[model samples]
Target: MKKIIEGKIWTAVCVALTLLMIVSAIWIGMRYYVSMDIYQTPSMFLEGEYSVDGGEWKSIEKDRYITDHFHKIVFKGKMSKKLLMYFGSLTISSKNVWYTLKTSDGTVIQSYNFDDEKLSYEHTQTDKPLALDMPNTPGYCVKTIYPDYLTKTENITEDSDLIFEVEYPYSYALVSYNDCVDVTAYYNEGMYLRFFYDALPPVLLFVLICFFGLFFFPVASFILGKIDYKYLTFGMLSFLWGLYMIMQQISGYLNLWIVDPTVCMMMDKITGYCFVAAVLFYFKANMSSRGTRIAANIASAAYLSCVFTVFILHLCHIRDLNASSMTMNFATAGSIVIMIVLLCVEMRINRNALFFLLSWVPLLLTVAIDAVDQFIHLPGSHYFNYGLAITMIVQIVRLIGDLRLQYKEAIRHQQMQKELYEAKVSVMTSQIRPHFMYNALTSIAMMCEIDPKIAKEATITFAKYLRGNMDSLKQTGPVPFTQELEHLKKYLYIEKLRFDDLLNIEYDIQATDFVLPLLSVQPLVENAVKHGVGMKEDGGTVRISTRETETAYEVVIEDDGVGFDINEQKDDGRSHVGMENTKKRLHDMCGGEVKIESVVGKGTTVIVILPKEGQPNEDTLS
Candidate 1:
């Protein structure tokens, strides 16, 4: 049992280490993706020439103006320049907007924007237009500009004269003039990538810790079952909950690299629902009854409904790539309500479920903060993700501590059982000595009077058998079959002197390479001679034989005497003391089975089947 427990611990540790390596690999892969050099630059230029107050057309000239604080051009006046170049912010009240920009040589540039403000216009002279149209020209041309990657200047020499126009104001004025342009790209800063990379080590450590926590739970369950300790089920449940949470954290980190926000949101919700279901299932299996089962089924149905609803919304385009806050809020509210209902059911069933249920406290806070953070565009929500990792680790530790206590209790119980068995064996062995000594002494005295020479031989055999019995009492394992047979021979020889001509014995032993419990065969032979042969008026034969069965070593002792009914005789406790002792010794030593078959006035056969040495029985023996 101790070896089994140790093996379990070893396996758990190895699995924990393996999971840690896998998590580390994933973390490294995520870090590598984040660190790759990538950038998205959105550039804009004038699409049409227009002034804020409908001013006259002015010549558009390339001018480089440097500010005192920063070396950058503020503005170059042009009546043909697009309205987007006149202001820093553009707010369109119209349902749609369209504009055109004309260049000096009558080239035109076209641009458009939806309600997405992040893709708003930005002004920069370095970002040249491909084509533009002069306010009154009918031809278009590309603007010349010095390329960043090339040393030469590219000019708008081809197709310089073209006319361009666009209809706008579907709902209201869709186009507006903007002067200042924000020239920023929507890409993560290098420092933010570094932060993500640095998070790998801690995340990997936490995953390893959770795996270790889960690994011990099954072993703890087995030990607890052995000792009948039911409360350890809580420890198992806690570890399972910890594992679910760790899985969620790992999945969340993975989702960051996935560009589809809808899929990411769905994954998050599914993970949360899965965690709740796992906890509820554990509670229902360990603590609650039919009512909890019904409640769990209802919660499960609700979660599935919510998942289906989210999918339908996405499919119908009601929830697009950028879903509105109201849609997300509704989903979150529905999920929380379902989870809260499940929590209430759990509380009604088991108050101790609170420990596991309370783990969601921080998770609930995270969800609320996540909602506000996404709306207000704030940071620190990632810290809540980290907080979840910490809570999972704490729960894992608590589970481990609980399992350790159960293991200790199991070990204690095993020790008590072993002690009780030893005590019973000792008492039974003590009962055999006095009666056996008296019978042997009486036989030797009678032999001495009748035959002096045979008496001396009988006394020597008696001495040897006694010595074997003494050694058997001290040892706790099977004796060699050869040694047991030799003891039986000595006992039969001593008994022969008592029976004289009335007793006839025969040995039909088969070749064997096995062992049995000490004195196992001798006691049965002694019982046959005393009870079976002694009751017959005519001389009877006692036969001892050893043979091999398909599965085990078989020893048979039979006597032809006034055979009693085996069933009626076995229940006579006082008469069957030797039979009981033989049974107990076989059980403790070789884990063999003893069977006695008899018929009144026919004969009695006692067969002992012992497993081959060094091999276990087909079934659990003890």
Candidate 2:
């Protein structure tokens, strides 16, 4: 019945976590998709360039044009035209002298030198005339020449199309131009792609899940410390993957170094290696022999060396940016080899390796997709990264479940141990009870036959001792110092009837602010009577006292009688169950210390020092 309830609770927890992961993934996907859609589309622009004659149209290459002294010029012509005059105008400043035609309208067009600062016209008689540009010269000169030609390209008729050659003197002579529509369009596309590829919605949700999941670690640790197979398995993998993502994000943000790309790629591969290492560690800690654990550690160290080597190569530029892709390849091969070794070991031991083996699938897929993307620049490559993250989360959840189960088993075991210990103490206490009762009854029977009044008194004392025992057993709260003393007095009175004039009892309790363990005082008093006074031939005195110490409340029971040898075993064949039971009860109840000072001729003194309220002094009891 208990198992069923526990199973139901665990099942519910798993279901809830699964639902949360799904909802978070969806939320992240949608937000990323929406943001991506909004930023991907680019705006279009329509601009025209004209030559003196009808020629092929040229569109400006905005990026190059803005930074160089070249402006695009274009026109078209037919084969019938013999010569065409191409007229264009531009301003020449003292800082800017020459102009160059950066791009021609047709692929076959070539350039020839023209006067440095002059605006010129090209004469072409051919049918097809190409477009050309004078670099770094302003359009203000053309406006001045034909003010009304704002929206038109003026064509000077000739036999053929015309072309002009241009050159520039300085590199920085090109003027910068901004087109709002074009810039806006570029930004939209770039931002949309970034948002889409990152999958912001799912990532945000996952972050929250990770944050909340951390709280369960302590609870899981306590309950499943022994059965750490699943906890270590999932915990190690999740930690590796999380670290990998963090490294990727860091590289993405700090991409100024030459080795950044390599580092980023290595980080991804290391994540997989780390996952494998985590699995190996989990198995080692769980079921692997010492030799297997050592081997796993050695293998993990070797893989780490390989990772460091890749990093060094990248930093030193021994391998180009393209060569960074090989890191993943090496890692993948290494992982496969390690996996085989682990599987073989597992097979030999007849242990289940399914979980560890299955964990590698998503990681392998992630590695493959990433490698392909880096080498060939394929589409949908980033989705593999997302897949890896999701896989890691699933693995974490599974690990958490395993941890929970282990925790439950541990708790159950502890409870069972506690019950067994309690039962043992109870049986030991029962042994002491019968012997003490038999002595008290025999004493009372003798008193009844000799003296009626003394017999009545002895009988009452016996009844009071039994009553105190029953009350102490039933009461859960700590007994006050004064009340516990009263119970001790009753028990000692019964013992007095058995020993008659041979026994004398003394008690001096000073500290009464707090309570002590229930029935604790009586047991120690009974021990003093049985062990200290019982061995005396003529007579004995039992002294009981309490005092407040600097750190604890001290209770002392000392008796000077026919002191038995402390080193030798007791002559009475019976067990020392009473003393043992008293020690156990004090340890459990108040966690107080029990000190025994005994000698062959001196006698015995049992000193019990209990801690005051608010202090859990387990050391004293231990």
Candidate 3:
């Protein structure tokens, strides 16, 4: 027991320390390579090549300086009509502002103006060519952070000097290309598949891995027997959370028309709220306390009501999509507190809850911290996904362990029922033959006239033998070796009176610390005398020996008489029933086995092997 406890502690420490090292390493490396790998090239724009508002042209390395305003960048460029002249891979949407391009001679080539309400695309407000089929809503440009991201390519007819301008209400706009390089040439120029590496966001990757990892628990549970409710609840919760993460990183959908952006945002809100409800229900599923679970259900219903109200209001244009997140985050914080209290209440009343609580407490605390972070507003708070992903991994591993242990316990319970039934059947199988009973009664009746004292002794012995055999029906588990030996002596005494000088009995008991199933070994002795020695006119000796080795206890029952072939098939009515019953009883009640060796016209040897170190349990002993 101590060894098992120590092993668990060591395993937990090793896993915790290992995860700490991995997360630390990844966080440090990601800090260096997150946005730099895609844009840090020799072809990047130089400081003196462009100017804003006719001032000195200074290079902008960071993405936060250009927020909520208009800036016109005038740069000198000598471009041949044969090469493509364009600037694309911008991460901003076109709703807040638009961009236009014109040459030094004031001839406008292309312009997109979704930001201005006064001008329409069909109305030639500016002397410029319009991009084809621009959406009324701002079309989101492709995310240049991903390798497969697509962008708009604008061609200039004859532009030696280009004036580039951005009018947006945001601080950051990722500029992937500022020169005349096409997507095909850019993909081949750099390190092989460098854009692919840039596409791999660490948090999104973890979320995807968790989506598959959380599903393994229910699969394992299903194989064990029935799937658990907690597994279903937690699995769905994890899937929805992963979906929320994926939707957050998706860049351009307005241009793609796969689904409306409004619908996508609505789905995000719906899934997020559903995940919150599922988490509360997950705890409620495992809860043993009726009052606590009921309270949790009410809390869950109330939270869901709030979420649904917000969702409906947002869909009806009563509230925008981003506005509901604050309300939901606050509600999530309230739900977390409610659960914390309920968990404590449950832990105090139910000891079985310790297993769930020990690992779950930290995860809940992390969730609470995350919920608060949404309102508190911390720098680099975008990386909260790291903590969430790690917690989910730990929770899944712990849940699997708990479910497997529960499965084993259920199997053990079923085995006990079977062992008890086998014990009862074994007692019935070891019943003394009716012929022996009639012969013993006849001898006792005859002895009463010849010797009254001998007759009384024989009657008492016969009564003891009958009582012992019947008493065995009530004993479903193992008995003491001493008690079993007394029953054996009573049966032998009755048999000896019938076979006066023909039958011989011997006993050798070398071990007595362990226990065996009631009537287990006695049946083997009965089988030996009835089928082996009793078959001969001059009955042979029956020997019963008990001994022990370092790891197991042994009982050998031997008879010197005409023995039947062990390989032969057993008939319907036979003496082999006792031996077969004993074998099954020994195996089912304890971790033991029986081996029978015999030869035709020779002798039979039956050995019962029981483990020495095995302590009898409820089913193994009374």
Q: Rate the local accuracy (lDDT) of all candidates.
A: 0.52, 0.51, 0.60
lDDT of 1 by residue, 1-622 (tens): 8778867767776877787788778777776675344322122222223222234443322231111111111222222222222222222111112333334554433233232231221323333232221121111111111122111122322223323223232221112211112121123342223335554455456555544444456555664565322334444444545545544434333322433323444444445545544544443443355665676556556655665665566556554312332444465466556556665767776776677667657756776675555345453335455556556555566566766776787777677556435643553464346776687789888878889898898888788866765665465556567777887787777667667888999989894567666666776776788778888898689999889877788999999877887556255445555557568667656678898888888878999988765444435342
lDDT by residue (1-622, candidate 2, tens digit) is 4465456557656865786778677766666555542332211111233331134445443233222113232323321111111212211111112223222343222222234322322222332222123223211111012211211443323332333322222242222121101111223224334433543444444454444343344334533434344453454445555555554443332212212122333444556556556645554544455666677677667766765776566456464222443554566477567755766676667455556556557856776776555445443335566767666666666666665566567667566546435534563365246777787788878878899899898788777766665555456545667787877787778777778798998767686665666666666666667667787777789998888878788889898865666677767786666567667656656677798888766688889878775343445433
> Residues 1-622, candidate 3, lDDT per residue (tens digit)?
3344335445644654565567556656766765643423332221225555467755544232222112344445533222232322222223233454444566544454454443333333443232322233223331122122211223333433555454332233322122111121132233223333433354445465444436544554565567777887777767766665565444223223322334444554576677678777877776878899998888888898888788777656666444556677778878867876787789888875666666565556665575565455444433455655666667777775776587667667567757666655656544556777788898888889989999899999889878887787677667777788888887888777777787899988897777888777777887788788999878889999999898888989999888888777868475454555567777777778998898777778999899865545445544
Better of 2 and 3 by lDDT: 3
Best by TM-score: 3
- For model 2, the superposed segments whose C-alpha errors exceed 4 Å read 1-37, 41-198, 209-219, 225-230, 243-287, 316-328, 358-401, 437-622
Residue 471, candidate 3: alpha-carbon lDDT: 80
Task: State, as a TM-score between 0 and 1, how close model 3 is to the true structure.
Answer: 0.47
Worst 10-residue lDDT window for candidate 2 reads 138-147
Global CA lDDT of candidate 3, please?
0.60
| Candidate order (TM-score) | 3, 2, 1
Total backbone collisions, model 2:
30
Between prediction 1 and prediction 2, the one with superior lDDT is 1
